[model samples]
Target: MKIIAAGLLLMNVAFGQTQLRSLRAVPVPEPSGLSEYVRDKASLIRLGKVFFWDMQAGSDGVTACATCHFHAGADHRPQNSLVDPNSPFRVNAELSTVLFPLYLLSDPRNRNSAMVRDSGVRVGSAGTFRRIFEGIVPGQAAELGRDALDKPEFMRGDMQVRRVTPRNTPSVFNTVYYVRNFWDGRAGRTFDGFTVTGANEAEGPGVLVARNGGLERQRVRIDKASLAAQAVGPALDHLEMSYAGRTWPMLAKKLLSLPPLALQKVAIDDSVLGPLARKEGRGLEEQHTYFAMIQSAFEPKFWESSERLNAAGELDPMGEFTQVGHNFSLFWGLALQAYQSTLNSDASPFDRFMEGDSHALTPQEQEGMRLFQNAAGCTRCHNGAEFSAAAFNENGSTRADSFERTGVRPVGDDIGSGNGAFKSIGLRNVEFTGPYFHNGGQSTLEQVVDFYRRGGDFAPITGDLRAFAATPGQTAAIVAFLKALSDDRVRYERAPFDHPELCVPVGHEEDESGELKPGDVATSAAERWRGLAAVGAGGNAAPLQTFDEMLRKFGENGERAHTMNEACTASLASLLGR
Candidate 1:
């Protein structure tokens, strides 16, 4: 019976029923859990945007959320984006692209194999300077230097430098639809106004100060705010964004006193800054402190009395904690969630096609769409408006087809719910979000399609791929269909997606022993600023290259470029028509 069904599917493809299906339109919903203190949703969104890109938010006063998510909602910097040496699937000897066919999986230590050049696991780049110690240590925070390189502790190896995150950085675009954020789905659906596990545990100040001076623990119970829960994860994560021993209170204190984007320039017409916009300038400005923004965006009750008084009868930065100070995690989480919730990329070509605009997608794209739903079996996991089964339903229920074990790695390498199961990420802007997969083991869409074609590299695969076969043309059509998921506003950095200038580390400076020194990491801010000067005189932040441009610049002889119709054709030749 199964064989007959497969034969019938093939027959349907032969009879040209591929273009019969269309993607459903998933409308972007308003963010949940806005406090009564917030007078304007638009103002709150602006505050979220500012905080999202503000460098002062980091302990080093340089790194921002935008550092890793700079290009097309995903990191595009090639240097320093390599896998750790101890990683189970470590293949590349150094930082380089992961090539096709002979991927790094069979042997963990085989670096001298004959395969495509620059094909290794691509991890996201992070801050080079971190707290000198491994874990939380008292007095370490005071020893931190503004310039990590100049700090004797870091220079002499007393402090540990930042290391690559275990998994690749997922794009923040359209993340509002996720039922649970993170590859492990650790960010729960219920934001407890505190930690990711707050839903299960009921220990924290579960209430907020009411506008009329009343206090209650249940004032803020955010639902479907996984992005908010996910937002606070990186701020405290030692590997991704913070120094060890750093608490939300410490980060909040540091940010409250410092001016937002102190190290970078804010465009005068920045949507987030509005009336608070300072003169077109660089460096820190006297106006628009994070404290002021927080006060304006939130109810006065949340921040006005949340501080503890010191011996001198003044509010202390670290003396005592209040519901507001403790609620910094809540504010940080929700503000980011509010901003990211607006990053819906529903204006893609495929979106138009789904909305009944018949000519929005080309005939080839239409054919590809059909193949995506039928022959490719992509609809099994990537169904609905977001092209992902993990997305929240219109009625707010989570679809059961969320996580799957595609066998990207061997079964026991990184064990979780199903040994190797990872989130089925949305395909929107997939062309820009590469090296594919949670481990970033594949470099292009063709490689991704090929992986699915072979039913994954390891055993115990989750999805059925027995009927999942396609020709080269069919694969190319599928790639085209994926590209149609990209939204143009994201490519141009327009409105809700607009961000401040960010200086991101491209590579690390090597020490005497070839170890990465804290100060040796190179940043793109100066170069980006120079580029911004050459082309324009306005206050709008400069735009980074689209994924296509990055591919052309980084790929060998344009063979590795993205978005081009033939980009994956050559690499996929040997695997086609299987």
Candidate 2:
């Protein structure tokens, strides 16, 4: 019976039914138990909320789970500018749009293609990026310096450092329902019947190993329990929070051991530590006080043993205790997972527009949606309620053991999309998450569309996939639909972070340049074209060529096929050129 079904699919393709095949809408589970911690118990959510923003969870007090998996609720960073450039990053632009390099340069690959040159020069996509890090003035130094590289609240005993994380952070907003975590589903695995399947799948180290540009094939079932369990990866990942050295248990104990006398005398009203510090003085001491306040803010009554503790003489007048309860760590995971479960955005206007709400979307948006679902073939992978398929495949027909290459395969020991390929990210709340793509290769929504329309990755240095091309205007409609996915209401905002007491001369100064510098030459037309080719050559060139050929197969204009050059995205060029 399975063989017969496969045969029919082939016959359908032969009969030109490939384009006519109807997409099946997979059912997404409703938000359940997610509200168990947040719906009515705002206090529990309140605790979770504070923890989400608390950078002290990491060893250095500089990083947080949120640092990479930012609440902007989308993929993190574009063009890998957020990290030290000596450590590079790359991605397939079509699968993502919001993470493009807004102020960084495309990585240069040295293959010969229609779009790139083998100059062996590594240039940033954003001219000002390097300058931002190196700093031209004092204020610039303060803004970009990595002085307080670790979290101020974390105990030094909790510090741990490892290799850079293998993949970009996925948004946590609507992750409650997801079974697997990480781009390659490397978390959530269980030891046996004791663990959830999804948890088991995501439990290993963050890196993915591909066999012949494919993942190891296997069947796995996922559930919300697994999603909740998988949420702990960052807290333990050395490159992320690196809390493994100072497990939540250790962190809790350390924070509990601090002398209340010092904490109390630290004065909620000291010049540098006062609650009103934000209004009056602005100094390093004030920031340190703020971090202390955040740690001390959790009401003592809710956490203390009250009457029992008083009888035993174990409680303080301020109702504080000397030790944190074991439940605190368990509660941390519970609250986080529960809150993430509610991150569903299925009720978007675009969803309604597709469900027969003719007025839900503007005509332009409606046309764009149509293009996304049908003409552009984007629905092949980004097809469900969350706007992506968890199932891995090679193209639409071939079953493969590895994750999708998106044709960004690198050349000559470059090790492009081998062990480094990421999972397909869901398209939700895309507008606020600038610098799109897994490795953040592209910088804008239109640029992402242009990438897909042209095909997948291009080799920037080697010019490996320079022959790939896309139809003009085909990507514009797709870009329109992606823009509609933005949810401004949920966009995360950064609260003031100050830790003056942590001002102990700060950590080691980084020698490498950072993103958003001021003196670099701006990306030009020629540079962008070379960038496109560079991206293709760096990844799976086969699909890049195949997809571009498919675009031409649909009769898109060939003469207008000038590749992106400099940093001017097609959409930007359209407006700037005019």
Candidate 3:
């Protein structure tokens, strides 16, 4: 009878739906030893939010981690967003309506006939212009630099445009559940607090935590802190945030001199920072120094030490550095992780339905849920509450399940999962994260569904994808079901998702002024800024646009996806020949 019951439960799981709230998130492991690094969790979270949104943190003083993540935890700007893999500059193509469905078949029903269009242009976030580092201009959130002739492809006429990241950024929402982060899982589960990779991969002595009346180089492996590990990479990455040769110490020294959010305004009703907010106008009223925030949020051992260190982080014979200045990266990574962990969005319509609110979902959405689990078999890989097999509770013992090859791209040597493996990102707010896939090839959820429904666009198949036919109504219902996972809080920038004003570089224009700026390299691309107004805990009234909505000219092109198949590879092999 017990065996029969077990079999029955398995059957139910196979066909029945599972609620997102049922599964446990990957535990956010604190840094080892030192008891706890945080003296005040609330203060620490506030610090994290400030760091994550502080544009001054960038070498140019105009970018932030929030720049790429401003829209529902993913980028949706249509201009200068497409990446052509063959381009030496890495990206130059602009996104447009006709260029989508990246690998479209002439016939939606047929796997092979003749290719109608394959733009080879994909989506990506635009970052800073490539320039050799000089040094920070004293007392400013900017750098002094001379330009070098970077890749000629990056050059447009006499000016150079901003560079684009190679991969499509995954949403940061509900990322606390992932065992590993990033498309290739380069951001490991154990944060080292120093290296770009995980602690296990760190080469040097690791994070410098003060000990025994003096500073010490100790290797601290904070478990379940992939978010921390992930947070450390982009800060110094010349392509992403910093100038070439920018060091954490340099960044720290610059920030320590400035008050919290000295470059931007803080909302009076900010979810986390409101208590520290100014009574009127911009910035905090108290002039909370980064040093003070660190001192309050972290233990005395972290910031109380007066150890003088050089740019290399070595104890200098003659130098002026505080423990806070030397170990800023560690604080930055962990605090950012703390803030991101709070960005959970488990309150969507589907979540409400799972919580016993039957009317939360429409009748068709309910049927779509049935099809997603039973017919579509989406639950097999996208199991658990997070709708991701990559969630730690679902695949703790295996790294392979952390990735899958829907065959979005071709196999290549040493290329990150170049055989098309990518992170099985959670689909909580799929409506807003546009230009789907690691390649950022597909433009809308409908386009994504169509890619999956007819079979993924690539070949040499072997994975969780295969062609299966669905009626138009069934397809629409599945899309509707996916949309039901979106949380209104995320959509409206409420509470944990609310952020400070950030000026993001959306595109480039001619340097019409023809005047050299402090960081200008050979008349670097005159940037165009898209200013985001700060939101508070109360959230915004305007609804964020879906990727489909953002791509206004795409029409109804968002209405397609490949069907999920448990065993259809042998049939698709010839159809999608390598």
Candidate 4:
């Protein structure tokens, strides 16, 4: 019955930076002079949340930004999460516990020993069908898209399933602190208000802004707004959400005409959208268009011009849009970042303990913290208030990008950040964001620990990883400490973390031979999906499940080591800590 007290500790983080135990003390890097562009911050956040969850935002009318980022700001679905990385999204298959640690060795300690498994199939989120963008169908959520002519990889006979992303999806919660977003640091430190790769785009014409009665190519350069930069990317990617040839103006045109969160139900008590929610059914009470939300959030110069911009999408050659519709990218990106900025999970048990609550963490968990800081060498990358070297405010030096070549895979495979260096991601809410790493090869936090214990899978250019001997007790303690990082608010979808309802596609009815399970789209139902019910600011009845819990439920019938039946999820949730 030994009691442990967590005293406040200050330590030097990576690259000559200092960080305190209490994360709230760290100031997130925000773009100043925002008042010139933003009209109302609250309205901007509301617009962001609604846009993130609205199915109408997707060209297919189903795949919203929240589809890949619902659970704790990251995807947790196991079915159709894997893709062939070597071939670069050649297949989208169900990932299982049996096939993991993609590149494995027979001897854990030996790197040159006989290989057990080397799978090219990496874990990622499933996205849109293979289709070409035609035009905004005016009042329709779906763009007037035609099926692609090419023989697509993600297919069951003639039926087109969803394509998977080559990279694993990261959480959007703490991204406001990142100097650059994505595994590849393509989402640059500065946002030009147009594209994610705006920094490296050779000083091209920047984001288009509406002036008196004409379009002006605004040379916008807002620093520390990488979240805004990253926010605009997936919305137009052919595999992620849009059809081929869909442009910003076209997508914007569609969204401006539609009602906010039209296809989804908003909780009446929602922190941001509650007052706007309808009294009895789906959508908001005002029945206002997304354009109205934009008007409420952004400055008049960005949207109030009388100019009409021609649609740039190939299929929508005849389509013309208003000034507000044309600059949708800038509005969407900034607003989403504004909403995500409030999503920082600084209320974990570890945070409370650091802020002077001794009983916040168990003694074993405190011991785990010590090992994590010292013996485990976790702080070399996972350091600072944000728990990531990639955090802009973490390091005094220019290492906030924190792109390290840890040799998880060969440099020739992906060439991330130029030389196989991936961004060192933050570790907050890690308990809920499993399937770890950029490839998402690990299933649980324990497996992630095991990966580090063995000095990583590939080692041609290992960063700071080296073999370490840790006992079972030490490992358990470390894992418990990791779990302590889970913020109660995020786990229950409370306050700023709450959102509208969403229906994410799980998988299609298909066999191993890539054949459909008979019937039409309704019967065979490749579009088989699951609903994530709306949670208000008051929070849900139970906390969200860890990745493994949902993974096992989605696993093959009776193949999961734990579950007797998949339907037992809700009943067993009580025993499983929600």
Q: Which candidate is the best by TM-score?
A: 4
Quick one: ranking by lDDT, best first?
Answer: 4, 3, 1, 2
TM-scores of the candidates in the order shown = 0.77, 0.50, 0.87, 0.88
Quote the positional error of residue 359 for candidate 1 in Å.
Answer: 1.7
TM-score of 1: 0.77
Q: Rank the candidates by TM-score, best first.
A: 4, 3, 1, 2
Give all candidates' CA lDDT scores.
0.60, 0.36, 0.70, 0.74
TM-score for predicted model 4 compared with the true structure: 0.88
Q: After superposition, how far is residue 165 of candidate 4 from its true place, in Å?
A: 0.3
Residue-level lDDT tens digits of model 1 in 440-489: 77667877777776666666777654336678898899999888887766
Tens-digit per-residue lDDT, 34-57, candidate 2: 332223344343334334534444
RMSD of each: 10.3, 17.1, 9.7, 5.9
